[model samples]
Target: MEHVVLTVQSQNQLQQALQQLDSSWLNLPSGRVLAQVYSRNLESGWLLSVSAELRAKLPNITVVGCSAMGIVSAGSDWNNATVVSLLRFDKSSFVATLLQSSPDDEYLDGRNMAAELAIKQRDLQGVLLLSNPTKLATTRLLRGMSDELVNLPIFGGLAGDFSQKLSTSVMLDQALSDAGSVIVAFYGEALRIKTFNYLGWTPFGEGMTVTSTQGDVVKTIDNIAAYDLYNYFIGIEKTGFFSSAMEFPLMANHGGKLVARVPIAVGEAHELVFLAQLEPGDTVQFGYGDVNSILSDLSFARHDLISFGPEAILVFSCCCRQSFLQDDPRAEIQPFEDVAAVAGFFTYGEIDTANVPRDVLNATIVSVGFSEEPAPAAEEDDWLITERAEMKMSRNLNRLQRLMCFISRMTEKLNAKNQELTRLAQLDSLTGVLNRRAFEEQLAQEFQHCRMISAPLSLLKIDLDGFKQLNEDFGHAIGDQLLCNLVDIVNRCVRHTDGFARYESDCFMLLLPQLHYGEALVIAERIRAGVAQSLTIKGIPELPKVTCSIGVAKFHDEQDTLDALLSRVDFAISRAKSAGRNCVKGE
Candidate 1:
């Protein structure tokens, strides 16, 4: 495989770049050639003329491109110029499709396009997608395509317009559409594709829940107007809202992965409109780009790309990243050139279908690497040397990154300790069962939940029969062991869903959700039988016989308070004790 990347600012520059390509390589009949154009200039007339000139020079090549906020070439990025990449593959072939569909028909359009691509190429390896973000439902389209092409990798981006007019275009040869998609499907046995994506945004501040939404418009966050939430956190004003918000996007978990969503506009009612949909109940945190973290992530990506050893690398990075990394916009793009020829564009949104439940990402960089050959083996020393040479950062930035990392680690440790303390507080120190207060709290919640679901709930109140007398004879230490032993026996007999708690000294309660009175009685009998078997107490000359009395009661949905349930169960236990020890009673 071979690739050439060049930048052109005019028709004359385009011709000169074409002349620089090897004519023999371009005319190779055995190899397939394709050209990709990423232009900041969205003028249809100029782009068409460039396309016509490319065809006149190299008639056998396939051409596809889109309008970009910024174009990327090997080792650099351009704000107002076009970057053209010509790739020649030795054993790979591809086909391109232009889907002209309305925004409302995006889902169906995606499904149909994927189906056509699948049928057209039996050896389909991957797909490259470019679409107009302003006129397409990107998430829905990706979902539709994902449903049809399961496990197939899709990598590309939405066309971007720097003018913010929301007008973007995708091209297929001489045809260009401002409101649809152009898909280039690559297929061949020898073709290999691997995708890597990273987000350098670190989440900060308290998490806010999505309270309300209308499609892609987020109406409220944490029950406050969406715009108000932004203002409260970042003091963002309506003027230049999109640009400001791009610096700090809302990071939320989508399909178990963190994805960023940039607010593009503020609605009349102060709702924030995003390019991607925000579902109600999603917990989001405000995130900002950290330069040190960004550079560190690039090192990881660089390692993977070096190992893959691709002939060409295509990048679909978010335009917001370009804006945020203004001081060094080419930091992420330049490293890939060390491994292979690189070309891409800064996009409105990036589509990554490599993982399950494909995501349309914001403030991320997604790199797609292509190779027709297997990866070459490299020693660990070589990787370390390359990583050390290429991975460079300012001293102050590195120190700041280390400080942030230190704080993040310390915070995690503190949270873990807090959680452990909470767990310890809720548990009985001796028997490791829920203590009285925690059990009561849990019972109240279980009661409410069972009532809401109209499900049965049962409780068993257990007491070691003659426990006080036993403790008086055996001493407190032995008595505590007996209590722990009984707990172990009860645990073996009860279902996993049963919640056992130490109600008081020598008394315990088991709260069972979705269990009827009959089932509860059976479990109580099992505990009684297990306890009656015998107690092998240490230092005891003879094995002491031990037993427990249990009372079972089912919840009355029509009129059962937590206190009432407890009272009835206690009364039933008293009845069991009055009848005889080592028995079960039910109410």
Candidate 2:
């Protein structure tokens, strides 16, 4: 099979492109011509004339066309221009159909189209879908198509308009549409198709939970107003949030893979609006994309196609990436020109039914490479050399890249070492609670804050009862296991905001920041009862139930020192030990 691409600058040049096709591929046995026309504000009637002209010129070949933001042919930008790619398949059987979707029946339309196509062509290997995304739900359309043919790999993008007026149009054969889709299925024994989807956004900061959502709008994230978080991260009001949020998209783990949810608008309640519906309580990480990482990802995609030896490379890159790259989208597309003919358009959202569980992706690049045979290593090596040579860089950019690499590695190693050191310094080695030093440091901070705000702060001192006798009877190993079990029970009883520490052997301290003496006494009693009820020593029937003596102390005014508070709590624990060891006392 052979393919030829013609780039036309204007309506006057349109005839020239068709003439090039006639001179080169006029008499091919079976072929298909796909045209991506640049739509100007000139007129809609011109489309009919252009379709008629293509039909007259290539009557035997199937002609499918669409309006695009910018036309790309062989990985070169040809905006305000038309790009036509003619593929002549020798052994493949091709079938093209146009299905119009009603406003309410887009899903049903997709199912019907797939079912009809399945009946017509039973040997299909894959499908190419081009849809008008202005009014139709493209995700539902893809779902319908998948329902009928689950194994078929579908690849294509939503049609686009030059002026962003939502005037995207699609054409199948001689028919045109502004609110429907066209499905083209290819079936044969000789065709081999491979697809790759790339998203290079790196997640930063902690993940936020989707606490509340309504349809495509997220009302609350982490219990804060979604728009408030949006404003905080984007550093802009609702008016500019949409444009500014393009750089940082929300990444959610869906279908076991990270998929981006690009924020498109602000809802009525100032909620962050997404292209896809998000369920409540889904964890999403917000992050930014790197330019170097984007290029690196595209380079890897190129390598995959090179290895596959594809004859044609079709790309459906998100419009966000195009705007991000601006004048340099060629950096993403041009790499594949050496290995295959490239044809693609920037899309609103990408549809990838090829994945094990189908997903509609946003802020991502989806690629499909078609080949009959694998490419050679020598040609791939030559392409690599050419690629490096063409990547002419300024001195500052080179230095900046090197510096970024060095800083990235250094930062990574520093973070890892810092985390290990912090873990060792802050946590008890025997039982994973806070060590005494860390607890005291934290206590000092909490104490000062409570004194300044006059908020309640309480402390608990706990000692396991009958420790020396039990150790002598059950041995030190059993005593150690029993201590560990007591720690677990205490941890389960305390609030997450409260801090617990191994004050010393057989003694533990608990700090409650927003609780008074009465609340602290209640928690101490609960811990006392929980340990007595749940703590068990295996294989030692001689031992009685494990219990603890507890003490509770509330922080007084600024005159009350941290040492004075500790002394009061320690004395209370002594009283508890004297008054029948397994009880709680407060002072």
Candidate 3:
């Protein structure tokens, strides 16, 4: 290999203007191959077909690529076509993994796939990855691969579309072709990998220490939910809890022009949902106040890259960032040619392995240039990666693990919160009982559990007799309040284990465990009596009276499931409805 050789720019046309450029020179045949392609968000079959054509040219390709945000067109908009940048060298040296749309078989093994690729590439140095930033978890993917490759380098960026809507990643291979990850191992000295990328942003204003954070949600800053810190920082005294506070650009020092020197968008939330990317214990303050200064710093990073000595390079950057420097992104890299450089298209998310002590978490980039010369493997050092991450965090990453714990625990609480919701789904929204679906499913489960325990299960079908008359006479709001108040009354009378669902608009089904026939009737009558008395909502002072008619039935060994029990109780409830309003009847 020449001290700096092989500059390949393969640009093929899909429809009109050619759209693609894959340039790689240094690791000619390594253990891994990174194949990425980006297309317009709404582009059609012809576009997908065109990409497949070029991908077919490569051997042993494991496909994983996503859409791109406005492709850099030397100052022109290139929205109609997709760009595919292929970087490959050496076979059997890299490992690629695909997470696709299918449940794995119990016998499925990933190690086997990796081993096969390793058998071909032999001396694997690192891993190259490509994934859709959309459906797939880019964050999770990188974290997972960091473990698998452990101390090995990983690099690539998210597929993007300027629209930021739904997009696809092409996973091209002769055997399996679809939208998923495909990992292949390379054998030997085909590629050289190292990185010179940084967050390239900074912190500004007075810093606020992250007090309490859970995942991306900051419960408090300065001991208040992080929103207050955001509001205080952004100078938003009114509606301090609003989402805008979080969305505002937050600045931190990754320690100079190397990481960030100003404005980087942080987190925020609105409505009842929280939306933020920052964890607690981080020191953040307002940023973007000086947009021009920030742009100057960004431009300087690219201008500085030519000094690194790359014969040719490709850039992957953040789409959220495009709008900020849309004025002239190419101007920053124009200096690349001044230093042994030929370059090509840029991307939404970029990835490169960083040698952080004992680990390598692939760093995403705003702009990174690859040099094919004997660059002496600056990537071999471990400290550079850690320094960059800590700098990116503004040296406030010490509490990230604790913050992740907070997020994990909170997630558990939210997942288990839907018991009441499940109950209401089966019942009428206003009624305080089983909804039809829940009643049925629970009836089956309770029946089975009781069958195992050899206990009795009672089913009561109840309806508000002449309830529609009240709705007609008293307006629906009063009727609704009547139903709500009625539930509170009924809940107290039922056993803790007993459940209920709304059977329909004016009807409900209650399951009473360990209750005999008489007990069921007594419970039913209690509901009837409670409803006869009118109740007031906490805010509303007036409401007309309402009552219910109840019907009851029981389960026996002879009966198989809940269906018959419901049928019998519904029949009895119908009889009560016919005979009189506000009464209990059973069969």
Q: C-alpha displacement of 261 in model 3, angstroms? A: 14
Largest lDDT belongs to which candidate? Answer: 1
Q: Look at candidate 1 and tell me the lDDT of residue 551.
A: 89
Residue runs of model 2 more than 4 Å from their true location after superposition: 22-24, 27-49, 75-77, 223-225, 237-243, 372-431, 434-463, 466-587
lDDT, candidate 2, 1-587, per-residue tens: 56566666555677776676545556544434444343322256565566666667766667776776555555243555566666666567677777787776877888888888888766777888888776677777887888888888987777766565557778876688888887888876787777888887656555789999865678999988888887887686766565577667888888788788777677777787665556787898775665566657767777667667788777777777766555565556766778778777676667777862355677888888776554445653644523421333446545645655665566568768878987898988888889999999999999999999989999999999998888998888998898899998988888899999998988899999999888788889889999989889778787888889998889999788899999999999999998999999988
lDDT of candidates 1 onward, in order? 0.84, 0.74, 0.50
Q: lDDT per residue, candidate 1, 513-578, as tens digits?
A: 998888888889988998898544767865368888998888998567888888889888988999
Model 3 lDDT tens row, 142-161: 55455445554555555544
Model 1 local distance difference test score: 0.84
Question: What TM-score goes with each of the models?
Answer: 0.78, 0.68, 0.46
- Can you tell me which runs of candidate 1 are displaced by over 4 Å? 25-31, 42-44, 75-77, 290-296, 377-389, 394-403, 406-457, 461-509, 512-551, 554-584
Instruction: Give the clash total for candidate 1.
Output: 0
RMSD of 1: 6.2
Candidate 3: C-alpha lDDT = 0.50
Clashing pairs in 2: none
